[model samples]
Target: MTSFRLHKAAALVVVIIALAIGSTAPVTARDSSSTSKHVAKRIALMTSQKAAMDMLTGMAAGRSTFDRSQARAARKQLIRSTGSIRKHFRKPHLDPRSNAQPLIWHAWKDFKARAGTAEAAAKDLNTGSLSGLRRTLPGLMQSCLSCHETYRSTPNSFTTH
Candidate 1:
């Protein structure tokens, strides 16, 4: 495979692993009950975004056939989910179930900006063709990774039940 293809493959694997870990990881009792609802909402939002991303990534990685309508639907879902990220994280609610770093609250503006970038990338995604998806999906994935690397705590860093 070409270097670019290898890079894309690596990114796809990272995203898949993240989603897997996030989905199955149990919640601990490290946080207060008051913030649990907020954290749950945040997790649900992220889960939805991950579901959409999984579909696009599958098509991009040639693991699944690309249907233009399905790709477009995923693109729309991403656009909506990314657009809501700032609102979802506006509160500094930390829960044991959350992988969010405290730095997110401290670096609020930067986090919002990163979310905006992801939203823009989602909106720019071209689902009209598989080629378009292959070309543009990396930008969206990169935007997500850029924010996640800085704002999300690894599952291993926190204790889980």
Candidate 2:
């Protein structure tokens, strides 16, 4: 009878210890699936931006014909993408491979302001004439450069400033 009681007490103690350890175990609060989706969205948005910019650059450099319709389409895409770009940068979705710096969330207001400026520049681009586009190109380029200088971190880059 005494042996039975001793064994029961030892089992109870072991169970209690296990419960305590289990309760204290680190839980992953982050939704990795959601994070991955956000990362993918961000990547797609950036890729689209690059594609649109490449088209613009090709026209500016005279490597491609200055098609007004194409320029307008690219400009419109840029304007639309600005909204998606903002959406994908939500604070909770951090990806290690992303070139987005933490400063984007830290200075979200400034980031949004830059995004707004970029959108406005895209809207302001004049696709009617080569000279008109040349005039507006600097503003669009500056908007891109300004954001990249502050918020983007390139692979192998030592600095974000």
Candidate 3:
């Protein structure tokens, strides 16, 4: 049982990256429309990540409360959506794509290791006990953050001013 803190840290990094992009505040004169299917793919990735983030928050809250049923439900959503979340990443880049530094594929084995950590965290989450989740989610979030650091830019990392 790895520490949930690690996972929590990872997830936070990704969340920060997502925030940096905001997926709002449209860029100027980029002609995003001019792009082919890649633009659509990026949009889908954004949506997918947002949904997953929402679900993960719920799971995190449920963790401390020992809400087994809630944990179970969250795990189910995660199991269904994890592939799509990963799928979103498996495409050509466009629209900044969260400052993904490209080292993700460059160090594919390390990337896979992070993914594996997330998978274990997910399994621990399936235990469906708030205590189990509380015990696990931190590490899970950490795993998420570690990977995102290499793949994305921290959201709101800079100010418009």
Candidate 4:
């Protein structure tokens, strides 16, 4: 098969993997009640960011076709989501369901700086072409992973669903 077809097949496989990894459903109302409004909003914001990242990463990794419009949209979503990180976590709201670590509140300045780094990375992402995405997406992903490593609590199974 052609490169495009291979990428398409890979994209399908990625989607299947995402579903198998429990990305198919949002937290139910019962779960929502376990967390505060601030915590819930923060979780939602992170979820949105994750979705956009998944799309962009799939393209950058040659697992999906590079559609400029879709890439741009994902980039935009990331920018917005990163911009909101501070607002969402402004309060030290915590709940059993929240994955945010206490260190995030203790090291507030560092957390904000990391959020700023993520925002900058989102703004820096270039969706102009596949090459641009391959070049810039890793930085953005790294920023996210850096913050998560320091601030996010380890999930029991890496699934929110």
Candidate 5:
């Protein structure tokens, strides 16, 4: 297989692994100050997602040079981060530092499905060509938008779905 094919296969495997990880219960460390740890994880997850989106959108829009290796790495990281979303968001009211709404835990099933959709879209993204990237971007963004609309809050207030 070509490098593109190999990367595609690797992305699929990563998505599958992520789904498995997200479906299982998270093993959290319950220390006296676990709230701070959860807040940190939330920050890390947001940063990872932002970085991944910047890379992907940059490549798609011709703003960044397309690098298959970098794409593969970003895709893998995104899958891992999405896997952590369920685990990280489990503890509600853990921190005032996040824009994550309490609605997340209330609508857990919908949130998990959205994460799964993003993982599957990441797996399906064919960065082999600009056209392929364009084709895949919408699916990925739609998944993100759906989750953000339903579960996340803005700086001012929580968004109602």
Candidate 6:
């Protein structure tokens, strides 16, 4: 398979693994401290997402050169960060964490589906074509909205869901 195909397949696998990790295990860490636990994970996610957005934006502004090595590095880091968030959702808790509503767990299937879309779009971004990344980034952003509408954060409040 070409790199494009490999990226796409890898993304799909990541999504599948994320769902399985989040859906199968019960969250065993539900407590008043749950908020902090979630905060840490959210912070990690926000940091990683920020980096990913920055790199992709480089493509848009003609700042990032589209090299296969850079794409692979960025994608690998994203996978690690996202996978961390996904595992946080699992881990045995009676209730969901801060920045995470019970709604996400309740609608696990739909959530996973939308996340997969974002992943696939990211794969398209890594397909070794700057033009392709430019065209596809918006679609991935929309896919992200699929979840954000339901899960919004209030800065450090960690109380908004």
lDDT of 3 at 23: 55
Q: Residues 1-161, candidate 5: write the lDDT tens digits.
A: 23354345434433443455564523322222566455555655655576687888899888988887787777777777666677767777554345677877888888788888888877777767778777987787777777777777763221211
Instruction: Tell me which of candidates 1 and 2 scores higher on lDDT.
Output: 1
* Cα lDDT over the full model 1: 0.76
Q: What is candidate 2's lDDT per residue for 30-142, written digit by digit as tens?
A: 22466644564565565567678888888988999999999988888877776556766865566544568888888898988888898888889888987888888779878
Q: What is the C-alpha lDDT profile of model 3 across 26-57, one tens digit per residue?
A: 35223244332343443444344345545556
Error of 3 at 99 (Å): 2.8
Clash count list over all predictions: 0, 0, 27, 0, 0, 5
Task: Residues 43-149, candidate 1: write the lDDT tens digits.
Answer: 66676677788899999999999999999988987898798899889999875456899999999999999999999999999999889999999999889878877
lDDT of each: 0.76, 0.69, 0.51, 0.75, 0.65, 0.53
> Comparing 2 and 5 by TM-score, which wins?
2
- Native-referenced Cα lDDT, model 5: 0.65
Question: How many pairs of residues in model 4 come into backbone collision?
Answer: 0
Count of clashing pairs, candidate 2: 0
Against the correct fold, how does model 4 do in TM-score? 0.76
Sequence-dependent TM-score of model 2: 0.73
Question: Relative to the unseen true structure, what is the C-alpha lDDT of residue 90 in candidate 4, on a scale of 0 to 100?
Answer: 82
Off by over 4 Å in 6: 1-35, 63-68, 91-97, 153-161
Q: Rank candidates by lDDT, best first.
A: 1, 4, 2, 5, 6, 3
Q: Candidate 4 lDDT, tens digit per residue, 23-56?
A: 3343422343424445655665766677788899
Give the per-residue lDDT of model 6 (tens digit) for 1-161. Answer: 23354345434433443454575543422222544444444544644565676776676668867765665677665555444445545442332333455576777777666566666665655446777667766775665555566744343321222
All candidates: TM-score: 0.76, 0.73, 0.56, 0.76, 0.71, 0.57
The lowest-lDDT stretch of 10 consecutive residues in candidate 3 is: 28-37
- Which is the better candidate, 4 or 5, if ranked by TM-score? 4
